[model samples]
Target: MTQPVPTTPRPAGTRPPELEILIPAYNEEHRLPTTLRALGAHLSRLPLRTALRVIDNGSSDRTAEAVDRVAAEGVPVTVTGCAQRGKGAAVKRGVTTSPARWTGFCDADLPTPVTAVDHAVRLLLEGWPVVVGSRRCLGAQLPVRQPLHRRLGGAGFRLLTRRLSGRVTDTQCGLKFFRTSVARELFAGVSCTGFAFDVEAIARARTLGVKVVEFPVAWSDQPGSRFRAGRDGLRVAGELWHLHRARHGTQRPTP
Candidate 1:
């Protein structure tokens, strides 16, 4: 049963948040509170008035209570529900609802460090439309590597998505920031709502001529991830094919 949820955000009145970081969680009652506190602590140091938001993807656990508990500690946490349970759907809900100047989503486990948020906001202020954390970029560190099967799957997935995602080295990084305007534009017409959503978002960015910056970070495989390569790989492949078909069908014929 769903318990009564958290607070209406502390209204900033005319001024919007300078940056809003979104945590998309599904059944994360055990793990999410730590992420919320860590992120809130880091965000507090930024010069910008940052706010934290969570997209509760219809979790059956006590996820909502965890968010409220974290917020009660003086960290501004506002959580919204996503009946559609998927990282992509949660991200869509958060980005579409955000009015902040800068917005982004990180996984509940947050393989990328919370400190990366400061650099992300800095890059957004420097006029980069999108800042994407990359495991494939130089200077990236994986203190713990993914199992070999997963790593091999990742490489094949990249090859399959190359055309749609442009030449972006890593599109599936859970850490990504966007100028709100760019995020709104890119995600507004998107239809994918799976793990493959990042690929679709990147593809849309290229089509619109918005630049995406890949920032290397110390990202690692986090425990308790919901994704199962064996079980979900076909679904992601199907989504990718659908994206290709949908985009291809809309193109104008060459002269």
Candidate 2:
């Protein structure tokens, strides 16, 4: 396990934040500035105390320095280091350390807009313990579509997720939220720490009877995605099979 290093200390006598958004980044120095600025601006307009944290997922770039720059601009952003090199690991560390009423993780590229945070927070305040941003759900707007091959791959992955975890149309949306206490408890038991981690996390949440709602959002396919269709896809499939067998005591379902 890796320990997180906080770049800035929280001021004394400050109220605990109502929400904390974690961005798990790997070599995202150039992208962090724009994403952090937009996120800070969006959060400022909402009527809630919010904080942002960037988990540096073993990036060899200036990702941490970029976060520090944002914090210096008085954005209330914090940078933390994660020795482990997986999105799920970084998110687990962030969720465990968060001291907010609600916590969630979003992709570094901001595929789902920062405004979706407000939407998710509203659902949480309305008694939804878990909220997910979905691009395939009703009312979703996709301004830019993913490549045809990628869309086909996503469809297959979604089918597998539905089989293992019931009725979740899109588990890999990269924007997920949870009540703080519930997030801590669930992440503590997480074992998958890669592309398929979302599937396992949602599956576990379902088994624990957590109420989850998916909200459709406006989305755009961002450039410089780290996911490699063939390599990462195979690894995710294997992990899904392992997760299914471990939980259900049966062979993995075919997508």
Residues forming the 10-long window of minimal summed lDDT in candidate 2:
246-255
Residue 182 in candidate 2, Cα distance off native in Å: 0.5
lDDT of 2 by residue, 1-255 (tens): 645465456888998899999999999999989999999999998898999999998899999999989888989788888887788889998999898999988989998778788789889999998898988789999999899999999888877767666777888889999998998878888888888888887877877778889999999999999999888888888888888778786544333
Weakest ten-residue segment in model 1 by summed lDDT: 246-255
- Which residue segments of model 1 deviate by more than 4 Å? 1-15, 249-255
Per-residue lDDT of model 1, residues 1-255, tens digit only:
966534356666646788999988888988988898899888888898888898998899899888888888888888888877678888988898897989999999988888888777778889999999898888888998998988999999999988787768999989999999889998897788889999988888887788989888888788787999876888898999898888786753221
Alpha-carbon lDDT of model 2 = 0.86
Task: Estimate the TM-score of every prediction.
Answer: 0.92, 0.93
**Best by TM-score, which number?**
2
Inter-residue clash pairs, candidate 1:
none
